[model samples]
Each structure stands twice: as structure tokens, then as C-alpha cells.
Target: MLNTGLLELHSDCQNCFGLCCAALPFAASSDFAIDKNAGQPCPNLRNDFRCGIHTELRAKGFRGCTVYDCFGAGQKVSNLTYGGRDWLQAPETAGQMFEVFPVMRQLHELLWYLREALAFRGAESLHDSLKLMLEQTLMLTTLSPEELLKLEVHIHRAEVNELLLRASELARSTARGQLNPAPKRQKNYGRGADLIGAKLRQADLRCVSLRGAYLIAADLSGADLRHADLIGADLRDTNLSGADLRDSLFLTQAQLQAAKGDLAAQLPGSLQYPEHWSVKL
Candidate 1:
């Protein structure tokens, strides 16, 4: 986590070893143009470690590539953990590097969310604990490849998640209306619920838990998602026109990229509008 002056927790391909392309596997489905096994270099991966189809990925039927976010794991594993020993130059570390990449990705994702919850409004009481967990997660990423592979990330994740849930509850409670009275919230969102193509336009979803929900192709136009926990929610093809997510919890760039959105939608300050989102809104 040494400062590289790059936006930490965001992908910076220039400092990476194309680990995602070589390490990740994808099937020949709607997202991918072809099937690729783990550790196999994508046919489109160039000698310089840049995607050959960078501009044409979606057009070339690799739509999934466009939505994928490594959350800075590529550069971290390549530059920091492995000490810039790329698979091409070192060769022997390739397998271990590939294995470690996903582990690092998960740890980094957790770090991102912890930091989010730490800064969230009305979550001040949990700040000390959040900072400690963030530091602990950061220290885990510095372990050797073998150590990283052996690490039981889920256990750490569960502990962190419990803390995060408390933070979420605290933050959301502050948003609960005492005077003017906010809209009656939508129902509690179970993880991985099938919400594909469900009509939910203009819904009041304040302070709800949409964690790991499948919101693919769901119409969420003009919905108010303030304080909603959206970690791991599949937002692919979810319409977000005019939706208010300015205070939503754990929303990632990949989610926004996978979903359809426009300028009219408000996002958390940390997130930027996806390039594909329409200016017309």
C-alpha cells in the first residue's frame, strides 16, 4: 500500500503485468468472446501487456472485460508483492502469481469497503475499529505468495463484514427521518436475489441491504438508493437513470460500468461517471 501517487484501489494498467488477462479465466458466454483458461494469455494480450482490443473489446464481444475491475490488485501483485518479477521475465513465479492475484483482489476489495464505511456519515463511532481492520487487511496483502495462497480470506472477511454491518446499520440509522420522515423503505434485500428485469422504477430503497443482489437488467430508474448497502450486487444492465446513489454503501466502479446510467444519476463522491453513461441522462 505504499503510495505510488496512483488512485489507490482503482486499476492502473500502466503499472501492472497484465495479471488479470493472464491469470483470470472466462467462458464463452454473453460476456466473453471466447473461452480462456487460467494462466493462459489472452489472444488479444500484446507483448507490452496491454490489451490488443482495448478500444474494441465490447465490439469484439468481450463485454465482460469492460466491466472487470481488479481494484489495483494487478499492479500490487506485480510491483509490490512479487517485486516487479513478471511472469515473462521470471517465468517460475507465474503459477504462484496467478494464484495470488485473486486472493489479493479479494483483500483489496475488502479494504476498499472498510475505508468507505469509515468515512460514511454517522459511522464515526466505528472509525477506530474500521481503521484497525483496514490496517490488518493491508498487512495481509504484504505476505508472500505461498502465505497469501494459504491465508483463509473468508475468515478475515467474515470478521470485517460483521464490523461493516454494524457500520452500515449506524450510518443508515442516522439517515432515518426523525422530523420530516423519509419515505417508507423498500423491503430488506437478500443476497443474490434474482431481480433481473424486475420493474422497480422510482422505488424508495433507502437504508436497505441489497448486498449480493442480482439486479441485472432491472429497471431502477429514478430510484432513491441512499444508504443502501450494495456490496457485491450485480448491477449489469440495471437502468440507473436519475437514480440517487450519492450515499449508497460499497458501490464499485465495475457495478456502475456494468449497469446502464446517465448524467442525471448521482453517485458517491469517490466514484466517477462511467464513460459509457449517457450525457443526455
Candidate 2:
């Protein structure tokens, strides 16, 4: 396992150009107050690159913005890639910068998981492979804006995902193996299966795959999710009080931010309880 921690995956907005508020388009809904086009700066963005309503996002109907995670890609693009170039000052460079932000974000997100996979005690044998992929993904984040825009990120993601799966399986197997006389686990769910609002409290979900699962508003309070893979799982409004997710695979801070959880939700050491867990938008 590499010595690097996941702290770098946390977004540092002070060094960013509000790329997410500019580069990503959003439809007006519960998450956003108005429809905004891609490449357009959000109206709430201040000239200094800070959210105008950062402290009042949830109350202002922009709860989505509060949870948006760039995985440190914003600062990487703003400082490392562009050398502190302010997009507003260089109109000619704005387009390329905006285009490169999402690509860099994806690479960083992959790097985040790859780094976590390396730390899984049960995946020791896969550390070398995970390290290589992590380095490769990190290198991709350093490409020039033009090159970044042209990268076949989806193809790269597919390759990295294969390794991630192997690592997840190894760790999950070890986790479940530790559970002597384990309880029954649901086996029918697949990627993106609809489980919205389903009552799953106290379910034995260890060593299962909830990848890309639509678990919106699901009642998962007190669920045992040890080593369950949660990659791409939609956790918005999911009740997670008392859920055991300390070893859950590939769970990101963004996922936790989207879900409804409390201090009782056992999270991986690298994660924190979101401050707005009880705030209703």
C-alpha cells in the first residue's frame, strides 16, 4: 500500500476557479434554484471564486452545490495545470480550462478509489497493481489542457474498474470470512438496480454489490454493510443512522454528502460526518 492518504481528495475551493459552478450544467430542481448552462459561471459565484451563499446553501435551495465534490480537481486545474491563471482574466483560456475540469475530476476520482484500494488489508497482493494504476491515473491528471480534453477517459475508467473489482472482491471475501456464521445477504441486486425507498433496516449486506444502485430515500438505518461495494450507488436521502460502512468498498465523500446519515453511521476512518446531515433543503 502507498503511503499517500485520501486527504488530498478533499476539495480545496480557495485554490479553485469555481470550475464546478462553471463547467457543469445543472437543471433547476430541488438541488438547484435555476437552470444553468455548461461553461457559464453560477450567479452565486463571487469574483474571488467563492460561493456567495456558501453558508446558506441549504436554506437557499442550492443543497446540490453544497455536496458537489471535485475531488481536489478544481485546485489541480487552477494551480497546477494553469499555474494560477484566473479564467476571468483570460477569456481565451476559459473554454479550454472549463473543458479540462471534468476530465481532471474523473481522473482524480479514480485516483481516490485506487488509493483507498491499496489500503485494504485483504488486498495486499493487489497493492503493486493498484499502485501502478494509481500512478498512471495521477499522471493523466497532469496532462496539458488540450491533451486532457482528448483523453478517452471512459476507456481508462473501464481498465481501472477491473482492478478495483478484484481488490473489492478480495477485501469483501476477507470481511465476510471474519463473520462466523454470517447472516443471509441479499444476492439479487446488480448495478443500477432500483431500490428507492426500500426498507432495508438491519439487513445483512456484507460482501455484496450495490454498485450504481438507485437507493434513493431507502431506509437503511442500522444496516450492516461491511465490505459491500458502493461504487456509483445513488445514496441521496438514504437513511444511514447506525449503518456499518467502515469497510464498505469505494464509498466516496460525495456519496456520504448526498445521503442522510448521523454520527451513529460507522464510516471509514478517512470519511467524516457531513455537517448538513440534519438540514432539510
Candidate 3:
């Protein structure tokens, strides 16, 4: 099982310096209400570093903020990297801090995935390698702002992803055997498949690799998606009512927010149901 303590690595906005609301620039689009430049405090960001309209973000056309997760990067940079000094308190260091935040966020995201991969008992063969990579990634998160700015996070991510993919293959292959003991062949669920508007209601997708699949507006109501690798899957407007996704891999809060689900839809413990979901149950 995943170490429950690792959950602390997730975003805790209360402990952050509102980096996401300030450092990341967003264009005025369907997802955001306004175009904001990088390093500029969001108009809705309060003096206390909290969103002024957090509760009504989606209703107020700031749905992008509702989906953003920094994986505890904000607090790590705010407290540890800068000794709890905020941008306003020390203007000289603000630029460097802002630049470091995104780098830390990417590293933390990789840590999240590696930690999840460590929980798979079926992937015991890759555990040692995963642990080593996790340690290396965690170390990167602790680097100084200057060091972080110099780091190439994508290169490190590529190295870690190799082990994660192997682990996923092992776990999914094992889950496939356990879930379907029969020798019946399954269709190739292609990577990056353009599954837009595909009707997949009640589909047996257990242990399938749906990585990078375009599931936009797909009708997946009541689909059995347990153990499916959903990394980078575009779930916008996908109907997941009554679907089982308890063991889905690499599924993130942003993807869930972009999709629609109900109380009857089973999600993994790491993810929460979006409040905007229309169906009660």
C-alpha cells in the first residue's frame, strides 16, 4: 500500500505563498476569466494570499484555478526555500522564487507518481529502482532556488518515467490475469487514441492502458476502469457517472475537474469528486 504519510506532499494552500495565483500566467479563455501575466498577483488574490473568490471560482469563470494543483510545491518554496519570507516581504528575491516554484512543482508531481508506483506489490521487481528514483526526486525538491532554476526537470522526469512505465506494465498485467482468468483476447486500446464522443458505457476496460487517450466528451458511464493507466488522458466532458476508477493510475485532480462525475462514480482515495458535478449520486 502507498505510505499514507506521503499524502503530506500534496497541496496545502493554507501553507503556501499563493505562488500559483501569482507566478503562473493564464490567458483569457474558456477556463480562465482574465489574462494575467506571470509574477503579477491575481486580481482576486487577497492580502492574506488566499483566493478572494475561491468558493465561486468556477461560477465566476476561473475554472482553471479550481483544477490547478502544485503538489505542495508552494509551501516547500515558501517555508523551506525562502525561510517563510513572502514575495511582498522581500521584493529583491521575488523573481527567483517565482521561477523556482514551477520547477519544484514538476519535481513534486514526479514524486507523487513514483510514490503511487511504490504501492504496487505486483511491481516488486521495480521497487528498488523506484525507491532510488523517488529519493533522487525528493532531493531535487530540496534544492536551493538558484540550483532549482539551473536544473533540467524534464530530463529527470524522463528517467523516472521509464521505471514508472515498467511498474505500470507489471501491475496491469497482473491485474488483467486476476480480473479476467479466461483466455479471451482484448482489443488494443491505443495510446493517444482519439476517443472523442466514443460510447464506452459499461465497457470492460480493466488493466487497459489509456495513456494520453483523448476521451473528450466520451460517454463512459458505468465503465469498469480499474487498474487502467490514465496518465495524460484528456477527460474533458467525459461522463463517469457510476464508473469504477478505484485503481486508475496517474489520474490527477485537473483531469477529474475537467470531466463530469457523480457520487455513484467510484474514484481513488487520492482524488475527490468535483463540487460542480451536477448529479447528486
State each model's CA lDDT, in order. 0.88, 0.88, 0.87
lDDT accuracy of residue 216 in candidate 2: 97
Compose the digit string of candidate 1's lDDT tens values, residues 73-112.
Answer: 8898999889998899989999999999999999989888
lDDT tens digits by residue: candidate 3, 1-281:
33334335678899888999999999999989899999898999998999999999988999889888898888989988898999988889888988999998888888889989989758999888998888788777777888999999889988987888899999988887787553246577788999999999998888888988999999999998888999879998899999999998888888888988888999999888888775653
| C-alpha lDDT (0 to 100) for residue 274 of candidate 2 | 93
Score candidate 1 by TM-score against the native: 0.94
Superposed on all Cα atoms, the candidates' RMSDs to the truth, in angstroms, are 2.0, 2.4, 2.6
Q: Can you give the lDDT of residue 192 in candidate 2?
A: 93
| TM-score per candidate, chains pooled | 0.94, 0.94, 0.93
lDDT string, candidate 2, 211-280, tens digits: 8999999999999888899999999989998899978899988899898977878998888889976543
Which residue pairs show backbone clashes in model 2?
none
